[model samples]
Target: MQDLAIWYEGTALAGALRGSGHLYMVVNAAHILGIGLLLGAIIPLDLRLVGIIRSGPIGIVGPFLSRTAGVGLCIALLTGGSLLSVSASEYLRNDAFRWKMALLGLGMLTIAAQHGGGRWRRAVETGVPDPRTRFLAALSLMVWLSVLLSGRWIGFL
Candidate 1:
């Protein structure tokens, strides 16, 4: 796998990005900022969903938080893809990176599942209800935290 990664690193994609030092730095910064924004957006809503902010209307907070998360997701994807393009095959074999990617994927899917339909939106639009909403909140919290941890671990591993 290391040999394959080396080969891949020599390919046109990685080669194109190899000496782009400042660009890599910029991408790294953007990735960090994106992750920060994502967590900021989700954490409050997760708290609300868990019934901490039961008084407010769900429609107000949920959409705002969701949109903020969407923006973060877009930024993360753009910067992350740029970073990955410079070393795709190596990342593919990186266990921690693989887990980060998987968790990121799952977290996005979970968000989609929660807000994809009108009925689902309507149900939670007023703010999440008791039991189910709390469970969903916990899931959201866990997924994003895992993504963050695995992403950080990728650097060390």
Candidate 2:
């Protein structure tokens, strides 16, 4: 792992990012925008799924928000990879970074499980919240919030 990190640090992209202040700033800003998009989309959808906002129909809102959040996740991963390449060695050693990665993996799996479940499909088709769907929603909310927090912790730790 250390050797891999060393190779990453020696890569041209990493060198360029490390050498250029303006480029780094742009990448960082893009990363933040991606995160904002993700959180903005997911939180509202989660709220609806959890029955916090009962006015809007979940069937109508769920697909749209999920798609939007998917796009955000793609953007975040792209930018995050670039950022990580800029300081791979340090980040690989950071406990917060590790936690963030673990949470991200769990979050993705949770999403897959939620979408794969028959109950989720039933809820989507019937415009009703099943217990399983609600449970997944709550789990998603917690996982994503923890991911966000851990990502922030990477900087301080």
Candidate 3:
């Protein structure tokens, strides 16, 4: 892993990204914006799930909102990968970055498990509220938020 990190640190792409230029800043800024979009889409839906919004039909709102959040998450991952490529070695060495990545993986797995479980399908079929679904949503929100915070702290750590 350390050897991989050293190679990434010395790669030509990394050097270009770290060069004295505006492109680097632009990429970094875009990544931050992407993260914001990701969080913006998911957080509110999570709130709704955790009993924060009782007016809407959970069956209708949950899937739609989750799909929107998924789109945002895709954008963030793409942009974040580009940004990480800029300084892969630094990020690979940064403990916060590693933790963030692990959390992200866990979050993704959790989402997959939730979707694959019978609860989502049952709720969609019956048009009924499921507390388990709400719990999954809340957990997803917390994981994503932690991923964001740990990502932000990577630079300093």
TM-scores, one per candidate: 0.82, 0.94, 0.81
Per-residue lDDT of model 2, residues 81-128, tens digit only: 998998899999999999999999999998898889587767777888
Q: Which lDDT tens digits does candidate 1 get at residues 8-75?
A: 67776566667778767877899888888899999888877777666657777777887888898889
Q: Scored by CA lDDT, what does every candidate get?
A: 0.78, 0.89, 0.77
In model 2, the runs with Cα more than 4 Å from the true position are none
Name the lDDT value of residue 138 in candidate 2.
93
- Best by the TM-score measure: 2
Summing lDDT over every window of 10 consecutive residues in candidate 1, give the lowest-scoring window.
119-128
Candidate that scores best on lDDT? 2
RMSD of each: 2.9, 1.2, 2.4
TM-score of 1: 0.82
Where in model 1 is the C-alpha error above 4 Å?
A: 1-13, 53-56, 128-130
Count of clashes in candidate 3: 0
59-89 per-residue lDDT for model 3 (tens digits)? 7776787787677778778767766766676
Query: Candidate 3's C-alpha lDDT?
Result: 0.77
Clashing pairs in 2: none
